[model samples]
Target: MIEMTKRIRDLEVSEHLRTLTHERFGTRGRFTLLERASGIGASKWKNFYYKKQEATTEMIAFWIEKYPEDESFLMTGKIPPRKDGYPFGTIPPHVRQTETISDRLNWVIVEWTSPRGAALFEYLEERSKHQIAAEEWKKTVLGEQAPTAAMVEIVCKARPYFAAWITCGSEIDSYDQVDPTCTRSIKTWRSNLLKQLMSAPSEDPEK
Candidate 1:
């Protein structure tokens, strides 16, 4: 039973990683077992105990950033009524208004504080489409399709912005405010997580 459970947990880890790579990196590939275990905190096989617990904490933080009512606790330092309402400092301070497309709509540009942030943003803007197709070809634990030339183009286009952002300063307090900074420590952890997710394999033979 223990061996059977371990095998099932391992498969779960793989599928999660595969889905994440496909959805986030736009790649269809296989994940090494180690990567799957680390990526989504799916190491346990005792039901949804681990995933549910961790996701709950993360979701709380996510919601705080997404709404205005959540701002009072953040801005005023008042204790929140809900247990989840811990004091979260100002919104990441990474996003700012870029050129305005119209009255209510403006392009928001994110200032990356580290190479990983730049990498992630670039992947989202340029490499994402290719990743979509790449996800379709995922095998057991490796990716078959390499990222395309068009994906490379998208990455290159984002280079200028990244370089410019770095030169001006890594932190963007606002549209005009920039600070030379290093978010490498934070990014390292995030990258490790991604590596895990990108390497997972799926249980569903059809997938």
Candidate 2:
């Protein structure tokens, strides 16, 4: 099963919404229908739908809520209904994705940190530390001390505020963060877990 937040990176939000509206109501929908159904402003959605602007996480949530069952389809253009029991945004322990793991980590960290009221300056500060810690982690792991699952779990659970920052949006490439600075930290953290996982005698598909 795919992570709830993972979706087709190139799929435009407006296009997905259009298809969802068509499927959910059993008819092709127009702007007025979309606006009323999703409770979104026409101008704003039109801007995104027409490619004048990209839809942010906030706008996409409205459309997703309308056809929650098709969330997987909306995310990947795949036919599988995302009617899995798990709720949106929470990582299911049973699904393992080497690819989506990084973004999931970012989502966990950001959500746990400034669950709300995150300011630009706050992000700027935390992002820098996250980068530096990652670089040092690389150096450490390259030696005799590879990362342990315990080490990764601590950071993932504790939700350290300093050292990483990424905003939510459809611009997420391959479920990786599009930090104007970079998605390197996500990759680096992924690397930390991958080293340990790959070295294990047996693999845990459920991880």
Candidate 3:
């Protein structure tokens, strides 16, 4: 029974590898080309497809790293998420925005002590200490040191005002005070963060 189970598993793995190879190369004639691209020897690659030898996690990781866009499919045997127009996975817009905000915040931390000459300069001065205190308090409460989604949302909400102040010398006192449109934008940003957290791929196959 154990040997039977192993044979079944090997067959499944072989079929998956064959399907992936077909999807990638479209023809068996390109098997050598794939072997060259993968940096795995021709005999080893053939053994993998024939189920004469089992593929290791290290081998799978190497392939995934070589083809990052196919990592999801290779690892999970599912279609990868598509971007706006691209067929393969691309970075989501909200993720890009979050990264931009994070970069700007890092710049602010290094380059500026405060929004020194802006009209909301006083508010920034008052809020800076409070922001630090709030983060510290949150760390104490969560007990885990890593920043959570809620923590990221707090920073995300502040990004637009920071950008406006840095770029245009705008006098926005707070995120809420921006405008109805800006308020909607903030809500949308937070919503996207929530959605991303919720939709993250589960590690457990049963899930």
Candidate 4:
């Protein structure tokens, strides 16, 4: 349990009420008020709790009205989101070789931040870019013609504004705007394997 106080940590004066919302309406425990709390739409509330997106001033006001005694929270002007670059480091060669996707996710969103002291407190801070070199990797690994930078960049940075489908879940979003590293050649491997399977003879002798 994250012992939340009357004032929650890391939230700005503008976003401060966000923490209170979480505290009063604990997301997991029994008797939690998240769904029961009335005002903001479920989408906005979910976005705020999971760090999927920042809440707007209008939404903030909605919550502020719910907690009238703390209405003074509105006086604090909206502080722009923190810009300290968080999600970057040269991925070690060994990590690239041995780490699974889950490992990479944990590295960025958990192990990396906890040691650096940014996990809970600076939850809303900015993240560093994770742009992979797709064209170069294609030329070297798949021996395929490299696509134009524009093409790969277009695909790589193309995560939808809202998730198109549930991915189970990922730690991709700190503030939910970080560009996810695209799966380029992995798609190629899948295509080639499918072709190989289609061309192979079936083992059934009875046919």
User: Which numbered prediction scores highest in lDDT against the true structure?
Assistant: 3
Please give each candidate's TM-score.
Answer: 0.24, 0.30, 0.34, 0.27
Candidate 2 lDDT, tens digit per residue, 102-160? 43343443334432222322342355454434333332222224433443454444543
TM for candidate 3 is: 0.34
| Model 4 lDDT-worst window of ten | 115-124
After superposition on all C-alphas, the RMSD of every candidate to the true structure, in Å, is 19.7, 17.5, 20.4, 19.9
Count of backbone collisions in candidate 3: 0
Off by over 4 Å in 2: 1-15, 22-29, 81-207
- In candidate 4, stretches whose alpha carbon ends up further than 4 angstroms from where it belongs are 1-11, 29-32, 74-207
Q: Give the TM-score of candidate 2.
A: 0.30
If ranked by TM-score, best first, what sequence of candidates would result? 3, 2, 4, 1
lDDT of all the models against the reference? 0.33, 0.43, 0.45, 0.38
- Give the winner by lDDT: 1 or 3: 3
Cα displacement (Å) at residue 111, model 4: 38
Which model is ahead, 3 or 4, in terms of lDDT?
Answer: 3
Task: Compute the lDDT of residue 196 as modeled in candidate 2.
Answer: 65
- lDDT, candidate 4, at 53: 66
Question: Could you tally the backbone clashes for each prediction?
Answer: 9, 2, 0, 0
As a TM-score, model 4 comes out at 0.27
Candidate 3 Cα RMSD (Å)? 20.4
Superior by TM-score: candidate 2 or candidate 3:
3
